[model samples]
Target: MGPPILSAVDLDKSYHSGSAELVVLRECSFALANNERVAIVGQSGVGKSTLLHLLAGLDRADSGEIRFGDRDVHAMGEIDLARFRNRHIGMVFQFYHLLPEFSARENVMMPLLIAGEATGAPARADELLAEVGLEERGHHFPSELSGGERQRVAIARALARGPEVVLADEPTGNLDHENGLRVMEVFERVHARHQTAMVLVTHNQELVSGFDRVLRMGPGGQLEQTDQEAPR
Candidate 1:
């Protein structure tokens, strides 16, 4: 395998609860290979979401090094980081954060518009919606779509910029079993189609089955590969 597309080294983060320091991450390190799918599973409050946020540059580590290829993520200034994230990193949250007034295609076209690539934004959004099996729903608003369909739209929006890596925090956590399964199928198809590397943080062990690597985050912010079997 070649060098990782994204990586973190000796990461540390802490929050102050009154006078007490809540250490969320300590010496945490990770790496994501090109086009690889990695699942991070752990008990609640184990910093899984924290790690994802740090990787996506949504949050800062008290001290650490985050790298996307040769570029240091944390080292970038605000404007540069924002631009980098807009063009290179895609983020998906458990709750679909679609704009209430925008249609599905409009939501998918958001990143493209923000990046000043609006020349063909509509066509690109349509293509992505089609990829996620939502071609016919492009005219609908978030309120009109079901939970699963909303999530699929979020997924389509995430892939809008053709990002090198997607950091997803519990992408399937908000859905029922059937909808969750549908979302997972969409992920499988999207990964296969775009070859986008993904770091998925999920509490559901069953969701990790198709990933290339499964990592368990300990309460101390340590990450280790797990040999635990996923239910068939």
Candidate 2:
């Protein structure tokens, strides 16, 4: 095994509700290995999404440190952090946050465009769309696509930058059984092919099968390792 690609230590976070302080994570910490698929599963309000957000640098922690390789994520300045996040960490949310104005191909091209590449984005976008099984839907806008198709577009967009870590929170929560299965198949296929470290947290227990590891988060943000079998 190699050194962790992403790691958090003594992660602490909380929110204030009037006079009460709701502690979400109490010094939770973990290290994700290279190309590892980790599922953090728990019911709602148990800090699953909070953990993912912290991992992605979308939210700051109350206390602790996060390391993406040797870079200090928590301590970096906003501009540098934003660049690092854009280049290294890919995030997928429950609601496919596709730009309604942009077509599936354009949406997938976003990361490359943001990096100041005016040319070659479209071709890369098309390749990603096809990889996610969205080649036929590439010209469609988010509003014109099915829920699963939208999610596939989102997945394709996330992979556009070839991120080292892909953090997905409730990625399949909005899909039906069939659509959810489709999304997972595409996600697994892409993950296996790219060797990207994927951390997906979901409340749905049925989707836990193909992950390399399952981490069950309790009601209080406690974590325990459960299984490590992954399909080949």
Candidate 3:
């Protein structure tokens, strides 16, 4: 309806291996409306993760413009970019990156602490942990949690700063079918509760049931809308 909450235009990215150049994205473009849920599906090496990284401002595009609402992400200085990312964007990787020594609640409180908002971080972290069905496990360390539980903790941490958008890369890649389903259920509950916009890069199509749209990334780094029942 209105301008997209997040958008990129004419993006291009490449890497150099030895004397050769490997192009990952070529003139790729994308958009996400406020509170929209989008799933990106593709074969491995199609630059799905690259696109996600670009969208999250984790990496800069060689040539492109990334805008989160009215802010130009790529144009910001390092300090401003880091602060912007900490406050506005959340990220979840395939591997749960929780600090080993910290309890689940402490891990979730990380973003708040980094942003200098530790005054009520503990209470906020507990609320997020509870939202993800880990209320009782707040005191447990990452090593003490199951694979599914760790991923849920990561999700809780991502939501700690009340980010407007969450960019997730293979959030359930390490889980079994049952665990994956549980994680998806948690995502659904979190979405309903917080209305956070999500852009998920996943190979598992079955986990994309309730997403607002499904995008298939081609080998050339172009994204095309795909049918819900599209062939795998």
lDDT, candidate 2, residue 8? Answer: 85
**lDDT by residue (tens digit), candidate 2, 1-232:** 5899999898999999899999999989988998988899877899999999898998899999899988889898888888888899999999999999999999999988998875989999999999988788888989999999999999988988899999998999999999988988887888879999999988776786888778988855788987644554
Count clashing residue pairs in model 3: 0
My TM-score estimates for the predictions, one after another, are 0.97, 0.96, 0.97
Clashes within 3 Å, all models in order: 0, 0, 0
Question: What C-alpha lDDT, on a 0 to 100 scale, does residue 19 get in candidate 3?
Answer: 97
Better of 2 and 3 by TM-score: 3
Instruction: Write model 1 residue lDDT over 114-158, tens digit each, in one string.
Output: 999999999999999998899999999999999999999999999
C-alpha lDDT of all candidate models, in order: 0.92, 0.88, 0.91
The regions of model 1 sitting more than 4 angstroms off are: 229-232
Which ranking of candidates, highest lDDT first?
1, 3, 2
Per-residue lDDT, model 1, residue 93, is 91
List all candidate RMSDs to the true structure: 1.6, 1.4, 2.1
